[model samples]
Target chain A: MILEASDISFSYGSHQVLEDVNLQLKPGMTAIIGPNAAGKSTLLKCLSGMLRPKGKVRLEGITLTTLKQEQLTRQISFLPQEFNTTAVLTVYETVLLGRVHQLGWRVSDVDTRIVNQLMQEMKLTDIADRYLNELSGGQRQLVAIAQSLAREPSVLLLDEPTSNLDLRRQYEVCTLIRRLTDSRGISTALAVHDLNLASRYADWVYVIQNGKLRCGGEPQSVLTETLIAEVYGVEARVTIGQETRPVITVLGPVPVASSDFQSERDAGNDV
Target chain B: MQGTTANDLNQAYERLGRRRLAVVVTVVMLVLVSLFLDVITGPAALSLPEVLTALFQPGSVSEATQTIVCTFRLPTALMAVFVGASLGIAGAEMQTILNNPLASPYTLGVSAAASFGAALALVLGSGMLAWTTTVFVPVSAFVCAMFCSLSIFAIGRIRGASTETIIVGGVALHFIFSSGVAFLQYMASEDTLAAIVFWIFGTLQGANWQKLAIIAVVMAVTTGLLMSRVWQLTALRLGESHARSLGINTERLRLQTLILVSILTATAVCFTGAIGFIGLLAPHLARILVGEDQRYFIPLSALSGAFLVSVAALITKLLIPGTIFPIGIATAAIGAPCFAALALWKRRSYW
Candidate 1:
């Protein structure tokens, strides 16, 4: 599958959040790593059809803009950064909701099988019968991921899925997402805050700044000290870690003059 | 080393399925028995044998017994069960769509709006629009209830149709309608005031075969429409964004469910007046029993509602036997305590 976006631009009323950004993705795990408020989530939302951008997004030969919402959603699943489920539904019941598109008045055996398999795959079987309110933060996060997986979508879009989780759980969740992307051949784009994790788990990396793509390449080539210093404004060292993956260790914040940050934002991109 | 086998899932499904079935069957049988008892225990009470004979062989019974059983008691009894069931289903739908456990026909001011309409009609006389050749009181009440719902929706649409917006809008409407009713009571004549007050204190005395038939048909069709989208409704229980990702049109579902709830609440309360707490309590009780699967939750809500109303109907008679109480009084008297207890003491979290 090929998902390509060209001249993609978006704005919230008077503010331009994204400007003439373009990206081409194939079925693999891709990570968009950037500083806070860098428009990574906005780009992902546009690609996932949650927001309409003023450019062309094509899946294979078909245009994404022309498709109906239901059709677009069936092929793409976007999990937002924050959500609180109001219903105290069981884990299994909530996960089964992902297959609602395929099920009718009654849940089919096939639907149940897929949901249970995801619970098993996501290692949520032990807590499947437990209410969502009873689960810890990490467990709930995994359960939500399992729900997204249950859709059997060909493309997965996650917005900072590991933001609230602990370091160990963050690693675990990212690894699991990476494995699912590889095994199922599902195209995935994750907006990430952790540079090391993105370098370690992501097959392709795109560094975004001010709603524009700064660079895109393999993790080793993309995670340079200069890009980190410029994009995140932090002093950092990039070195090879276990499994030959790039590891970034931040030393301190690079305190640029106040005028630099303000000027860059004020000089809005001309789309 | 092995993942959970399909056999395990199959076993769990079977066990839960049986439990659901047992709960349904038990409630249904209880309702059936209560329905039978409710029909015979009126002011002119009859023995079990006489009641059964009257039921099984209506033609052979004396004219008086027949009138007591078939004409008066039977329709009211059936009205209690049907009205309860309809309100229950409507309550569950409101909770799912509004994403608030406290949202129901009464809490959202739909009932109060109807109450205001009924009060307004009585103050003006039922012949306010006699040329229409329809019962103006119920028609007026239904229209006002629907208008209140639409007003809430309009407010929501203008400023993001979120749960909080709609709920606050409902509360505001409740106060507005309540004030309207109070004003009508203040201005009414002595006879008009009494009639309006009696209507406000909802009853089953107005029950008859024709009214029951019309409500039953409306309920059957509306409930069918609701049941057809049971899965989507269940998914909606998750959250707006989650339902959207899972391929549900959240906006459309919200609009449709809103219209359907207005229809249910308006029709349920039009003839009956403003009965409170049943709608709020029934859905919460159903969720506790069924764990939020709308297929079971919705039907179970209906059955539980029927059980509650039937019980209330009996309480209305037995609380002070010589003088019967209006059904709303008994419903509030019974339902409020349970609702308060659940709010205070119930350990389980509903949403």
Candidate 2:
């Protein structure tokens, strides 16, 4: 296993976000899929060392919290769901910042070479000189990913990497992530909202609901209709496609209690 | 992949380099001009050549000229530079730490707290309240500033308040301190009341070697400490969780920076009284010139602040041919317009 979390628990004051969570990520893509309030992002934060847990998160047999910052940063690269650039930095300069842990103030030749190559790989060489604020959402996301990869970490943690992107950009970003995992054999854990995207790309899936792991297996076995309806409070149809991936479609509105129906109807009639 | 675009890239690089070089040159020129202007503006209006001669050959000058140029004017000018630089760096650090574009030292209530402490010292007197005013003015100011900042930090931490909340907190604290000082002024003797008012507006009339030495040492040490943490500060711009993931102790870093900024602001306020707006304006000027990298931002803010204050002091001295205005008045008069211009420029950029 490249990354492992054992009996992890976390809370924000009285609200428990994660409890007794155990996970193992091998050198492939693992998608943590769940509804908004599920402990998916929280668990990823603990594993990535962004948040501390009561138990242990070990990467390559070494405890994450005990490791030095430079060592941990070199080992794991985390791309947050939202970030703002204070300066109008060029793509190259922003990407170069990823090497700050390894290369202090002075940028080495190797650092520049890696940044240039990543920019090319992400198809960002064309806009490398453009300021971060000038780029479109898709272009900015690509630059952000390239920044994460510039560290060349063994483990990558991304939260909602495609949330703000359109459909084509979403597919493009996911494809890029898939290529990085397969070609470099880097272990990746992404908390994704689009279940179809997760089912299509993830080598393994962990279904979480209400701070507990509901199920874990290959996408085909784990994304069942009952699980979707139970967790999301929605009626959904789940079918295994010819490509061996699960296809989820929302069928209708969730059933509401009679009281809720009467109030909604009254409000609607008034409108 | 190869022809005009490659040429465009090369041209862009060249343009950026040239622009950066121009900014550097302009800053250097401004510093020199400010320094020179500071030397010439005093009771005895010496020519530029006479000013240079007096500076190089101090013993050759008459006792009155020597006292006017070296003892009185030079110390005041140096204090302006140091105060300006410290405030500028403090403002920049506050903005970066809070991740708020509008955050400044004043926005965190550091200046207000410092003014309150200074007012307490002036009204109560060091002789009567030795513990609170004499030995503890800066300390009390620092503690109050830190306390107020922590409150704002906590509020933001819970619901994750925006930059606007921090600014509002600062404004509220400003009013609170203003009322506290006003109450003290109302109860005090006429002489003591006048002194408190002067302190609030700020002045460099009492500049001395001891004050200059203290300011110099604090500015140097604080700037050095912040410079070393440039990388960590850069990581912090990514957000606290992101910073923690990179192995940085986010809480510890934030605490350390807050203490440093509080100390720097309090110390300056202790000597120069409550000089406002330099902390808010200087950092913006530095950012515009040096980009957002803390490595450049910290030093550039210091230099730019020093230059701005020095220029203000010079202008204040020159405005009244026979007398000098308080450096604080000049700073506000100059800083307010610059701030207005920055706001306008920002609005234009948005459009």
User: Tens digits of per-residue lDDT for model 1 on A1-271?
Assistant: 6788899999998899998998977799899988888899899888888788999888876889888877787788888776677675788888888878788776688998888777777767778778888887778788888888888888899988997788988888888888889898899999999898899888899989988988898899899887888888887899999777789999887677433744554665532
Please state the error at residue B225 of candidate 1 in Å: 0.9
| Cα displacement (Å) at residue B99, model 2 | 2.3
Tens-place lDDT per residue, model 1, B1-351, is: 334455575567667767987888999999998998788787776787777788889988888888878878889999999999988998888888888988988898998999999888787774454622138788889999999989877877874558888999999999999999999999988877877787788888878888789789888988888888888998887788777767688888988988987888798889888888889999988888876888889899999889999999988887787667888888899899998888787665645
Best by TM-score: 1
lDDT: which candidate is best? 1
The candidates score, on chain A by TM-score, as follows 0.91, 0.90
For model 1 the local lDDT of residue A100 reads 80
> Pick by DockQ: which candidate is best?
1
What DockQ does every candidate get? 0.53, 0.31
Each model's TM-score, in the order given?
Answer: 0.94, 0.86
Model 1 spans > 4 angstroms off:
A257-271, B1-4, B126-134
